[model samples]
Target: MRLAKYLSHCGVCSRRQASRLIEAAEVTVNGHPANHIDHVTEADHILVSGQLVEGPAPKQLYMYHKPVGIDCKLRPDDPSSLSHYLPPGERVYPIGRLDKDSHGLLLLTNDGELCNRLIHPKHHQEKEYRVVVDRPFDAQFCDRMSAGVPVDGVITQACRVEPVAADTFTIVLRQGLNRQIRKMARYCGYRVVDLYRVRIANLKLDPQVLPAGHFQPIAMTELKLEEEEK
Candidate 1:
């Protein structure tokens, strides 16, 4: 496995962070400073910051209801980072991201391969959100949004949009553009007052089960995933 993937499987950090650690000369393989981002073996001894890492840790996944104001990055040095909320010493990376101002169901996992597959837009994983706008939205807004909306110089793929209230609505999107829903609303002349995610893929957020800022383990068997053919 690559050094970064090995570090991630060891529950030490994400692949990106692992690369940074390697570039800073904080990692060593077999008692020698490691410089390459690739090439690591299960038999090779690994060390980070002068501490030995035994081997890959057990794979785990959790569904977390992230809170607003928490940056969705894994920076232990930053107190406000979302990774700080995870169990102490259990390093996991968010599959995608939610900006600091938006909160909802965020997936965390140590399985780097699964994380990559889930976030790839080609999978067309459905993400549902509850939105509140500053002003009342008519049926026309839902129609336009469901048809398609221009954002970031491209036409957004058609999504399911339904009005919940005069100022509230629900939307499901498969594309994870940067601040997508907010940008779509803005283009339609509406200002979003609040946005919360409620679902991702097959996982649905049950507030009574896991409230905001809380998380729980999810079984792989619960999700029927197709294994890629070699």
Candidate 2:
């Protein structure tokens, strides 16, 4: 395969971005600067920015209950990062992100294609959250949220909003904007005190089985994800 395509398969970046990296003279093949966008066979050695770009690592997918205060960045050196919580030497990235303040089921994996599929808005993957707010929850709050509310100049898409208590509700969103649920609540004149994502796509967080800061390997078939490496 072409070097850029191989880089994409390594989860480095898309082929276009890989080409840009190559153009910048950041890629090397067999310890020498690579000048051509050439094909790389199994016998050839490739590197990008000093990092080896070999065959894809073993594909792994984990259901992680990210506790509050841990940021969803793949920084192994940062003690507060989600990567710090994983088993040692297991390099993976979050499929999508949960802000530092939020907690719950986050999918982490080495499979870039699966991550792209799940995070792409076109898939309409459902993400459900349990939210606690400062104001008393009312039908109007549910209606406005269900109908869609303006957040950062863009109105949110229609979603399922079910009241769970006087001050809490369960929300299901097909779209993920930045701090989406929190922003939506603030737009509706409420302040979120706590936000917990309980589900993503077809998987739900079973707290009793997988508690906070804990993780478990889940079969790709459980997520209905194909095993294609790239």
Candidate 3:
């Protein structure tokens, strides 16, 4: 595999970050600084910043109940980064992001391929959210949002929306755009006061069991991604 890909498989860093590390001479293969496009094999000795690089780790997945204030992006200087809540020494990253202001079920995994599959727009994975807008809205508002509203210069995909109350509703979307629910509501003259994801594909967030700021190991079988193509 290419050195960057190998590094990503090893749970060291992302492929892009691996390239930056290689450019900075932080990685060595067989005692020589690694080239950006170098291929790696079992026989090659690799070191990343004096730490030996080993074979890829077994894949791991977790269901985390993300809190509103936590940032999804991992940054060394950010104390509230998602990394801080994860188990020490596990290099898993979130499959998709929930903006800092929104919170709910977020998946973290070490399997890069699975991450790509879950987040890719072509997959059409269902994501359900419970939302509360600042003011009461009528059936027309729900109809407008369900039909598809313009957000970020593109019409959002038709989605299922059910009103639970004048100010609250549930929606299930097949596409994930940045702050999509908030932007969509804004376009329809409503402001989202609260947004919480309740489900992703077959995985559902049970607040009583896994409350905010807590996480638990989840089996890949629960996701049922392998059955999608069958």
Candidate 4:
């Protein structure tokens, strides 16, 4: 593959952006500097500028219950931070993100391809959240959220919203839009008292063992599903 294409596939950036970085003389191949948009092989030593251009690391997956107040960054700028609270060593990024104020089950991984597939707008993987609101819940509101609310320019996909209590509801969504739940609630004039994501596809929090601000390794076999009928 061309060096720029290789960089793009590795989640570095797009081919054009890679070319710009290369032309800026910030990229290198092996120990030597690189300046041209040449084809590069897996065996070739490549780098952006002085840093070595090794391929992205092998994919890794973990489940973490992110507590409120922590930003979803691999390297947080805050000295007193929750990511800093993670075990030291290899860098892992969140597969998707949960807003800083929300708490829930979050997946952390280095697998860019899997991350892209799960988060890319098309798949619409299912996610479940337990939400607490400031006032009593309404069946009508639940119906509207399930029926899809128009926000921005598009309508939300029809979803599953069931009341679990007088003041809370369990919402299952297949979309990952930014602050989507909050936006939908705003449309209905509900103030969320608490928001916690409880499920992602085949994985759900262990009600018996899981807790906030901790993590557990996930088995690859669970995710290694064979291709099947769509």
Q: lDDT by residue for model 4 over 1-230, one digit each (tens)?
A: 77776775564544555677888887777766665657777788877645565676555678888889888754467853556866456455677788888998888765555666666666777889999888996789899989999877789999999999998899998888888998888889898879999988878887467688888878755653223226
lDDT of 1 by residue, 1-230 (tens): 88988887786766666788999999999888887655887888899998887787788888989999999876769999986798556767788999899988998888766775666666777889999999997899999988988999999999999998999999999889999999999999998888999988778889899999898999865544434435
C-alpha root-mean-square deviation, each candidate = 3.1, 4.0, 2.9, 4.2
Per-structure clash totals for the candidates: 0, 0, 0, 6
List the candidate 2 regions with Cα displacement exceeding 4 Å: 1-5, 11-44, 225-230
lDDT-based ranking, best first?
Answer: 3, 1, 2, 4
Q: What is the lDDT of residue 115 in candidate 3?
A: 74
User: Per-residue lDDT tens digits of candidate 3, residues 77-115?
Assistant: 799888788867787888888989999999988876677
Model 3 clash tally, residue pairs:
0
Local accuracy of candidate 2 as per-residue lDDT tens digits, 99-196:
99999999977776677778767777789999999979779889999999888888899999999899999999988899999889888889899999
Global lDDT for candidate 4? 0.76
Measured on C-alpha atoms, candidate 1 has an lDDT of 0.84
lDDT of each: 0.84, 0.82, 0.88, 0.76
**Global fold similarity of model 1 (TM-score):** 0.84
Worst 10 residues of 2 by lDDT: 221-230
The count of residue-pair clashes in candidate 2 stands at 0
Q: Which ten residues in a row have the lowest lDDT in candidate 4?
A: 220-229
